[model samples]
Target chain A: MSERSLIASASQTIGPFYAFALTTNTALGVMAQSGAIGERIELVVHVVDGESQSVADAMVELWQADASGKYQHPEDMQARNPDPAFSGFGRLGTNAEGEAAFTTVKPGRVAGPDGGLQAPHINVIVFARGVLLHLYTRIYFAGDPANKLDSVLAQVPEERRSTLLAYPDRKRRELWRFEIRLCGEGETVFFDW
Target chain B: MHSYKRTLPGTQPNRRHDAYRSTLLRNPRQPLIQIPQTLSELTGPLCGDNPIGESDNDLTCHFAEEPLGQRIHLSGRVLDEDGRPVRNTLVEIWQANAAGRYNHPVDQHPAPLDPNFIGSGRAMTDDEGEYRFVTIRPGSYPWGNHYNAWRPAHIHFSLFGPSLLTRLITQMYFPGDPLFDFDPIMQSIPDEDARRRLISRFDLETTVPERALGFKWDIVLRGSGATPFEDAGK
Candidate 1:
């Protein structure tokens, strides 16, 4: 079907709860156009089987600490410098190909829930069916020293910590691709919700 | 029923035989793209505070109602390509209680809660894509964001089609809701006319006038095109 027809058909059944937003470079809007930042970060989140195969059409919600470790959401929790411009919450559905990409500037250092400093990183949550019984998993950036001190990260067994961090990508300059493996043999270690 | 008969788009139907099939198999296509039209152009909130986990102060809606009325009956069908009915598709519905409060733990608002309003239900579409439910008319409640604001009487729907990408979430608003214009979520939709497509039409003949209005809503899911993620390594 044409894109128009597809959207028509899809929109017909979509309930009020589901809101579609672009997680691609478009989410950055003008911030992406600013050339001042060093190497643009390309985050590729693929919902796939345990073996790293793609699981398209999965819904992914990302909530991260802003530069000051504050979420822009109006929840009970508070942020130090909640940038009115930064929502800290991003929602996107994986394309038919099981991959969702976000072109965003790397997040800056923020205070951890405990008062210690947390390394600048993006937090990711992946939702899919095979893993339906469990709705989401957390994915983090690799090599940040804060990973060692972060309370949430420190709680997980060291052997399973790699499941949350993405491999460093040097070829695309600073573009980091985080392939989220939903299920299969090498399933990323998920936390107890 | 004879008075309800409408002519087919193409060949004149043989009124004597196969009239039903002819109507069913008509070229289910409309050349006229009726861009959605609506008299009330109200929109609702798109994104904001996560109301799901908010406090109790803002959670009260549908807290009171005389629990004596018969169950409100709602029935509908799910149609596929070629206008065939798909059976066993899971249908889920949630609405504000009669008092406009959802039976969720996170809601702490001062809205009333109807002990009678279950606020949630589930059913499977039959072979003919037909499904039915028993519920109550959810109440309209106030919100902190708007001045004298109220949400239209509506139900939140979630459908899990035979396929994964076919999953859909939508809302169904009743006709003649005075608060329809003041809702933020309804207004968030990009197009004003397209938004009306979400409202349900009233059927007075079947509805118990003194009781509740019968509304018919038919939802169409995407059936054609390469389902997304087919080419990727699965």
Candidate 2:
């Protein structure tokens, strides 16, 4: 090995042709079935640019705790257990309508570091061509009282906190809609973490 | 205390002048958020013990018959910024067929698609962070990125590190691709050395005589050279 040896390859944007290279039946959605456990919910995520135009090429991934508020990850120090049927992780690519839909159960409240209860929320990671790097954020159910007590939500600016909430659809009982704006006014409150 | 360099530079300014329609450089209202790595960002998703068959790592064997193209042996190791092996991680790759056409629906390129090639494969790193895949050599294809622009032969790679923050998605290019000089996507990386890092080298030892040529490419995940997240405030 010599000095100034090549490091790993530099990343290029996941251009429009990403569908050509990356799309797979399992990569688009991870949940094995809809009959897992807890309250079944349908999450509709619309990714848009600053101009309010849909971003069809973006990839959206979701991570959440199981119905019992336990994560499937090894880092979860708590002794709580994960629901055997729930993988607690999923990935979906935005379609021409800029929507990435996931059929999952509502996650339960998890215990925060300070022994306080954190709000029920789903973590999201967005990757697109122009994004250069992926963006991190969370989706909290709108009108949930837990949002007022969540330590993570408290770190976000009061005015922009609403951007993280998703409202239930009027016609569809279990459907919720959340719009993520990558730039411009009303951009979703992206967290550093 | 360890000091890390901001090795990767920001987006290039010259790219905005390119005629590519999908270029991010032309996005006048892009967000300017400065990302700071936190504990959640630093940790990557842990993979479960999904069962793998012998053919999982071989892209050319999916179809009933062999894929129609020149066979290639691709091997690589996953390393952290400190140059230590990153074991138990997943390495995935996808690419076009030998005709420079994809097995996807949206690819309308005039090139013919090989029915025997689905063009996707995955392999988990061993204890030493090594992964190998046997696949056909992909060809170059034209894109609307610019006038008469064609992409060079390449393979897309996705890696999941120990933590979420280290997840890397990049493309591996062949050495001496003629289109390298004209590809705006490849030129987006500001550093000359970083661009060279994308090219895989010919490894005679790994080559199968009279069967396939071999190429070796190692992927380095974020670590010492990563931009210090704290500097985003300045």
Candidate 3:
């Protein structure tokens, strides 16, 4: 911890050939172990570019609270009842069709910045070749009762709010499908700190 | 848990730079919305110190035989903009083999992939923010970016500092590479010095006599803004 000044290193694209190394262990993509609690859902994400074409090289990361609204992190000041079985972190790379899927328990309501209840949601970060900087966004359950009063969702425009929701697939009751558009119409709502 | 701070856009790469062909339709034209840094943004995975295996940092020792090409010792520190140590953070790296061929299925490059080398490694920074790895120098490879375009040999890096805002994924290059001039990705950074930071310097101190060469490159993540830099031009 010297007082020497150093500039933060700049970012570069991950390039097209990083899949073999970065995504070697796909087991990290599975969040819910056998005994994890809460509602089990299959989370599937499909990514598309402004050209309405699939982005096959993208990598998606998910971080969230366990079923009890407790994060498996030391920084979670109020996670007194953290779930030992839930790590709440997962990483997966998209396939040829620009799709990545995960099986995890749905998060519970957590306190917001104002100490109010927030909707159960998952924090998502996207990394891909040509994406100079990683993109930040969140996934909210479509038609959830908490969406009406969630703090973060309120920040997005009413019209674009639909972009954050994940609709239930027609055939599977516990399956949720989300679409992330990098640009053009119906672009996903990205957040910044 | 030290939080990240201060975003100086000029010092970073642009998201929508057009020289890179893939960014054309994948970059967002809409502005990012500001959000409160609550539990989600404030916290990250609580991976214990050095969760990686003992041999994980030594990419060259995976197979029974040694990997071909120049074996090098790559090491460095992880610091914040405030010059404070970012300790116990995970540092993951991936790169092309010595022959510039990847083990991936999609890489159609004619270069050969060393069976002994996997081209990826992981390590955790110590209490002093220092990390090290034993790997071979990756070779320069051609890409579809432009005619006769060759990318400077580089190792891809990924790290998750304490908080989500501190997370980063970047690259590390060799000292003097001719491809820097032609590669669109390396040219994407506007500032010359900032781009130069990506190039690791040859460090004789860390070099092994007959075992491996040594290179040093420090990664500075976004952190709280302090007194403005007095040495800007130099």
Candidate 4:
């Protein structure tokens, strides 16, 4: 076999329709029950193949606490303010080369383990074949002063804490960009069961 | 004929074949379909480095094939029980080079190798399992086991079947390869005769000698599989 043969073999394709919308359209952290700060933000995640540094095919799922820091899942026994409009969950699969994009609203603040509250953000979980299990991480908006104060963000060791957040483009206003690399250089921290 | 004669397994007439014959006569059951096999077929379009679109200036990396091997125009149609050509079925294939070393990250077995040989490709079974690919003859490689370890030149295949759960994975070995006697993955199947099913038959009708050696290996996935998981419970 020649190098040409190997190069010829490294191609793949993504299907026509995105898989998420097939089941649910509920956006994660889109609102509070009373419909308070329902501002929408664009979220983009780039999935990469750790071994080859190539984009990998993957599926992404996201969910989070609502404006009042609550989830509507029926199993939750805590008598919290449940937002019928905001289910606090959403799912998206990556393209053939491991690229997934989500256009969703930023979730508002909620109470943390400590008395201090946290900022509006989205929680992201990714699934690919290489990893033995699912990879879980979070995305925080840059430029938000509350980001520095968010208790969850503060707890992640300094170097690792940055991996869970994204930088904001000042000129673009609400626009923000975040890329998650699965392996190789600058790999995001992953948690285990 | 190389001055050789082969003996049949159970045809030694008056010899004491009592126990084996008695068991076979009592059992009367055929055990051919119970074994498991791996599927490594290829389907879909011939891939280039860039999957986005047809770009003439596409970056041909060190591992990319600039002009790939001469493609053998092998084409065929796959029909179901009802004789309908099954459309949209995925076909995949992987094989050794004239020297063996899968173009995969996990395969590390060494042999005089072609650095550019990826030896893998795919084509979708048209409204039938009908599909085609352009590839070259894979080579054999040494498994480094001194006592006995060498794999015959073969191709791995996989089929998506009709559904997610219905997928099937298998491999195709070239016949007349003495290494088949020592390959572990092959021996794992338990049934010696069934193991031969994985090796392709040397069909003179399909092989073009100097041009290309062609083999038709068809597969059936378990059953109509399920769709992609939708939510938590699902």
**What DockQ does each prediction reach against the true complex?**
0.04, 0.30, 0.62, 0.02
Q: Write the per-residue lDDT of candidate 4 for residues B139-219, one digit (tens) a residue.
A: 666554344456566655544443212233445666788877766545444445446655655445766668655555444
Question: Which candidate leads in TM-score?
Answer: 3
Sort the predicted structures by DockQ, highest score first: 3, 2, 1, 4
Q: Write the per-residue lDDT of candidate 3 for residues A1-193, one digit (tens) a residue.
A: 3233666788888777778777767887789988889999999999999989999999999999999888877767772877767668888899999999999989998878777989999999999888988899999999899999998998899999999999998889799999999999999999887
lDDT (0-100) at residue A3 of candidate 2? Answer: 27
Alpha-carbon error at A36 in model 1, in Å?
50
lDDT of 1 by residue, B1-234 (tens): 000011112211121122112111111111211111110000111132323221111112234644433346566777653344656666667766676666655345477755655466556676788876656667776655445766677776666554322345566787788876766556544455456756777666658666655677776553433334541522
How well does candidate 1 score on lDDT at residue B232? 50
**Reference-based lDDT, residue A145, model 3:** 98
Candidate 3: stretches off by over 4 Å: A1-5, B1-3, B224-234
Q: Residue B2 error for model 2, in Å? A: 14
Q: Which rank order by TM-score, best down to worst?
A: 3, 2, 1, 4
Put down candidate 2 lDDT per residue, B1-234, tens digits, no spaces: 122223344422222324445544223343333343332333336663655567879998876899888899999898876676888887878888999998877789998978788888888999888999999999999987667999889998888776665666778899989999888777767678777878899999999988999999988876543333543533
Q: Give candidate 4's error at residue A172 in angstroms.
A: 3.6
Docking class of 1: incorrect
* DockQ of model 2 vs. true complex: 0.30
lDDT over C-alpha atoms for residue B160 of model 1: 50
Residues A1-193, model 2: lDDT tens digits: 2222335456665655666545555544645255677877889999988778998888888877777777776656567677887777778889999999888878888766456877888878787766544667889999899899987778777988898899899999689999898766887887642
Worst-scoring 10-residue span by lDDT in model 2 chain A: A1-10
Candidate 1's residue-wise lDDT over A1-73, tens digit each?
1332212221322221222212333453222334423335656776665444466546565555445444443
- Model 4, span A14-89: residue lDDT tens: 1111132121334432222345345555566766544434444455666565555554443233487655565455
TM-score, chain B only, every model?
A: 0.61, 0.86, 0.92, 0.56
